[model samples]
Target: MTDYGHDLAFGSFLTPSAGTPEQTVSLAMLCEQVGLDLVTFQDHPYQPGFLDTWTLLSVVAARTERVAVSANVLNLPLRPPAVLARSAASLDLLSGGRVELGLGAGAFWDAIEAMGGQRLTPADAVQALAEAIEIIRRIWDTDTRGGVRVDGDFHRVHGAKRGPAPAHDIGIWLGAYKPRMLQLTGRVADGWLPSLGYLADGDLAAGNLRIDEAAAAAGRSPSAVRRLLNVSGSFTGSGTGPLQGPAARWVDDLTRWALEDGISTFILGTDDPDDLRRFAAEVAPAVRELVAAERTAPVPAAPVPPAPVPAAGPAPLVQSRHAGTGFAVVPTPDDGVRRSSRRVWDEAARPTGPAPDPARRYTRQELVGGQHLIDIHDHLRAELAQVQDLVEQVAAGSLGVGAARSHLNTMTMRQNNWTLGTYCESYCRVVTTHHTIEDQSMLPHLERADPRLAPVVDRLQQEHLVIHEVLEGVDRALVALVSTPTGMDELRAAMDLLTDTLLSHLSYEERELVEPLARLGMH
Candidate 1:
């Protein structure tokens, strides 16, 4: 005898026709009234006709109780991995571990095309998905020490740490059907939610077979991975009795197919509160009673427990006073957790040309968590040293125009690296993620601890602007020449200019901070 449990979860999807916020909450209250196992809300970032799901859920979490809440699926690739993970943890912590993260290798082509974003091939999207998922979990691990540590072809997170792993470990659900993807599910995913097809038009058996094979490869029993699905709208209560009435019959059809396939979760989507209410009131109770009876009557010496149904209980976010986020910024490269990308070592590809290629120069990984800002600071330090050496030599008469030009090329690399890299990664990426951190985590601390150093910070920022202008000008005139081996003349001119301009800024900044820095030279 198999240990049986009748577990049912409910889904809420806001559509163009869905009611207002007040109405949605009213529907939620009724769901709690009906004892919904779990309530999942759909999220579509660019869903024009619907509300931004997270914002809505944030509000819902506060207003509702006794019902678990989450995005039916969150398009994770649309956001920075760290940002999404932090939000996931925050929701889970607040909800007492009731949050579920439903992810997919994004296929929202119209949305991507609208934003002018990188349109990924299927392979690329899956590659990104793998890295993104790892980044999410690494940030979650209780033992994660220091800044986040992850280095892979697609991403590098140097700074990350966040708190209060959800009361319920946030479950990961994959909304995919491909074979390689199913393998990923068996190996890593917490569950699989495949979409149901109508009649002979679709082939569910083939996909399930693929999943079974993948599970074997992943060293797991085929039944170990949780399986679920969305029932097609045409499922009428046509085949069964009152329990098989339009709604019950519809659910029974789904339940039978799911049980045979080792799928236990069924997400029945309906915008009508009444229709869902009927399922809860008329159908769900019957299933639970039957399931409980089966569990109690089981006699097999070795009974496999029925998969625990994902309970749709209490809204995860309601009635919590967590004003500030407990989730830390996911560790990124800037935090010095992971080694930089392999491309970092391939200096042969480093651009010494006039203008840097924005796309090639910066990977999507850097902009995600302020690693770009961190890198800009790093390159600035390196560039400053090179410029300082050239200036000191020139001032001492040990160097002339030829020496100046040679060093100037190195200056150009630094200047351009900062110019293109900073905007592409820092102000553009970091500020975009969490704007207040600039003023909160950084600027205020710099000012409060050392007001006298204010002038130097301003000067450094100003040098950033100057570097940009100079690099752009040099790129226009000398990009092609630097790519090749020779032309010391071109290098001499760039070097002379950068050494003069940048060394001056460094000297000024040093003068402003000399007193403070001298007090604790090594520290």
Candidate 2:
């Protein structure tokens, strides 16, 4: 096994479609909301249909609070390294050090030439990229006393003053495939990014060997360079092919990659919101859990000489550890309070999951499965509070509609009631998407794993529908708030109803399903 011992990370790779600029930004924000570690966009600056990758990255960084942002493989031919370094450093500072650089050799010579960028042969392109990397690093080396200077065949920089260092040690990841480029990645780059689609059978192994050899030859540890793969596949009901199956299949495949091939980062190339959610909520955590288990699993001890039997007196009584005591996942309990007079479902009548067997022992990994559900719900709870706070600000006149609209315009959440409506709508979509995943994928899996959970699953599905209707009510109230002066009261009422229904349902679901999930697993 070639495990590099790096922490695994998951990210999203989105197309910078200028046609739906707002949606692109929204997807990036959703990456952060859904607990993804990074967000990336492809760069094709010559294409008129796509947004400028740098501009989109800046906007995404501004809008998202946690997720790191990067261009999948920025075209170096069109961007000068000295200036690119400064721009990256500036954005990294602004975004609180969440910027990564993914650079590439030039491609599409005709388009590059048309855009006033020099086109070169494959060998020349790789050379140019190496030269660019040197200049970029030199420009960022502000601690050095002298000005940055690099003179090469393709790029030349002399006496360029360097300062304004990045907020963090930004990784320079290269999208490399060819031998020379791969060698360069192993020698200097912090990461190696390659697309899975472009790789054939055994290609990943071969590439890893090459990179490792190059790293060793350059007096560097192979583990110094993190491996990242850009992946795309369908989510089917069963195993169809590699990465083309349910979330369980994804977990298995990615875990294998992490353990055997040393790929520490997996970036899903997708534009569909549902796929993004499933990848984040289902596949990512399970993969992390499994990889962690294997890495930490104890190695078999060498054969030890058996100790001589002592006095065969009374046989030592072996007491098995208590089972129920080890099940540490505690479900969040409902406070039995309601914010609104409106009631969606009769909570008292909800069906309970099958009782746990007192003899069944639970492992730490199994408990994490149940805790994962609560963690996701906690994120939703926090976001809902933010939405409510935004509404309150608007109601109190602390934030005027025009000013809110202008502020939200920068985020690109374009809607009639700019601030409150945009936020509420986003939250509503997240709730809807969460319910959809559970209904379609999670609940069905639970039903199959243990038929006794059928009734509980059925009740949860029903609650999901009721919650959907409540979300629609909130959306309608938002629309009214845009045109009617008396809409604030109605909006508040809708939010109160949503808050009550959502929290109660979430608590009940956790109470019913947490133990079962811990026992049976999320898949």
Candidate 3:
């Protein structure tokens, strides 16, 4: 439950205020300049003080080069589905696929009717939205032989020509929270868009469930539907209020939502330029770093074996150790070399598993299984040292900033701001993956094969989570290294913590698991 396995994205949700239309566009540009991933505007055809969402999006798309532009929730009643589809596709083409569509069921019936739109009941509106979704999809299906055709109650598109595909696969995000709307979103939409301010207590979780269930029922993967949120808060003196705290609070709160609530896209709704800058410059990257760390955190339990064939019943139990066996008893290696300056855990306090029977011996499979753990640990040890070297090299002037940048440009780290950020993220992923394999496959199998190993297995599992936190600390330091003047000291300290935890955890795991694994083969 550490992560929803979705990529984290951040954006600005600026209000389309008619009074300051230029300011709204300027803020959208500012968001791109500050590293925000997206820029969205609200739509309300009946609101006199609001600018037209579509027009504003067009202007924004023209101005910004990288950030995506979207209507937070386009007023669907005022814009026909077919026309909306064409407009979205055209803008997406013009913007080089930097466009996402967020549509909403009609709201404010009185105002809808005043604007020459149909006044549909709540039930009718939901039905209308569903039909609209079908119509839009049909219009975008250029590969189909026939013209677009969807004979629906509300939105029937007959023989409409379908051409001019968007530059990329455009996602249709829905602003929906009610059960029926949530269900519709799961069944058809690419993303679920909701504002945190409008959600009541527990609504976020409940909505996710509804959407997931609907997606499953419709034969779609739940992860295929992206979770997006419209959030608002202020950076005041004290770290209080929902999101009304400093940048650190924003990072923590948003990261928790991604980890626990499965909401990956965070769109901050604010008109203030300073708030926008802070959210982008400070909060966004930190949230990404935290969520990414957690996503690869160790799994708590064993996963179902891949392509597991049905067994007749249960296999006969074998003795733990026998004197003469298939292969030589490979002893667990202990080089007695400690690389870390600080010890993270009390190794003396580690609980012991059942001792192997002296009479029984090990098999070739078991010997290989045990040595595999050591091999993995050795790899992690090497990677950790490299990570430390990278940080120190940058700090000590052995590697100049320009040389670091040049080296990074050849790697995936070039996408990130700082070299440390790229290196730390990659190293953390490797460590997390190693822990994940052991926790999910190795430890569970060992525990099941020998129940007496429970205490040691539990301790190792706990250490995995602790190491995850340490890795996150390193990530936070990496983020700071880009903006803070004296970030090297912080980075070094963070790396030291990681080195302590990781080295200690790896040693403890190898010591405990090697013998058990040698006695019982890994599944």
Ordered from best to worst TM-score, the candidate numbers read: 3, 2, 1
lDDT of 2 by residue, 100-163 (tens): 9999997898999999999899999999999998988888889898998888999998999886
Off by over 4 Å in 3: 300-523
Candidate 1 Cα misplacement greater than 4 A, ranges: 1-10, 14-19, 162-164, 197-205, 221-224, 232-245, 291-523
lDDT for model 3 comes to 0.77
- Measured by lDDT, the strongest candidate is 2
lDDT agreement with native, every candidate: 0.51, 0.83, 0.77
How many steric overlaps are in each model, in order? 35, 0, 6
Most accurate candidate by TM-score: 3
Question: Which candidate do you rate higher for lDDT, 2 or 3?
Answer: 2
**Distance from true location, Cα of 244 in model 3, Å:** 2.5
